[model samples]
Target: MTAAKPIRCLAFDTSMTCPGVAIIEVRKGKPTIKALSHVKPNTSRSHAHRAEVIEGWAMLFLDKHVGTAGFDYVVREDFAGKTSRSNYPVLSAWNACERATSRFGLTFAKYKKPGKDTEYLGISATRVKSLVAGSGNAVKDEVEAGVRRITGYAGTFANDDESDAAAIGLAWLIDAGVIEKPKGAG
Candidate 1:
């Protein structure tokens, strides 16, 4: 018998200052992190320049991977809807990601903050943590540790942003049934 093909997923944790991105492959229902990186925008640059930098990087990453095996899914962690006043940059970056994903003819999923509603398709943050870290209340460090443990990834991440991207990808895999839910998960 031949083995089934793996599902490829690209995930992002978006921010104005630093955004994280990861590519994962699910083979035999186990997810492996293929690549992970964080993009830091130059703070001294104007908003337009920073946006251009982010958009360029995002497109380059997608172009590099989308031509490979092609992705089965794309996901981005949704921002916490605290107040509309402070979320413009995040929303802008997220919109760029959405546009890039659409350009590749792929539909991306947005994992939302718990119990919040938004126009975009969203899954709650609690659910993501539960699926990825085995606890809905898991902190950033714990979530990062869980990702490391799950993928056996040895490389160091610049910050929790990268790890969070990995976690977001894992959550999507779990939600898609590409990966099994971990024990004690909420």
Candidate 2:
């Protein structure tokens, strides 16, 4: 059989207040983290201001790192909370991400369809935790530990936000059959 080509993925733990980001590259079924970061938008302003800030940040980030053809696809953690307070940030983040990705012409075009699809996806936090940490209810610390264990990342994650994004990326790779599931992960 022939070897599989490398696939790069950009994933986000998105929020208007602070959005975490991670890029994962898979070569021959092994995963590596290419970059990781998070942005804290000025919260003293209105939601519109926060959304614009997020959109600007995402656009700049994609332009610099992703360009026109950087990764295979982008994935964000699905909003999985009951609080209405969380709605503004999540919606704003998704809108900004969509706008940024659309600007870059990045969509869920794994098949390279002909027309404008403009599709993206979100992996649930429970599913991400389950796949990465072997438990759906795993907490932030455990998810961080699991991500470190899987990616062999030595440095500490600035916060769980970054780790969660990394976990989401890794889990997407595994779920899509792009990479084999890491040992001891669910």
The candidate maximizing TM-score is: 1
- Give one clash count per candidate, in the order shown: 0, 0
Reference-based lDDT, residue 158, model 2: 79
For residues 4-101, what per-residue lDDT tens digits would candidate 1 score against the true structure?
88899898888778888999898877788898877899989865677777777888888887875888878877666677756778787787777777
TM-score of 1: 0.86
> TM-score of every model?
0.86, 0.85
The regions of model 2 sitting more than 4 angstroms off are 1-4, 67-69, 80-84, 108-121
Q: For residues 56-105, write the lDDT of model 2, one tens digit per residue.
A: 88888787788544788688777655776877678878888788888887
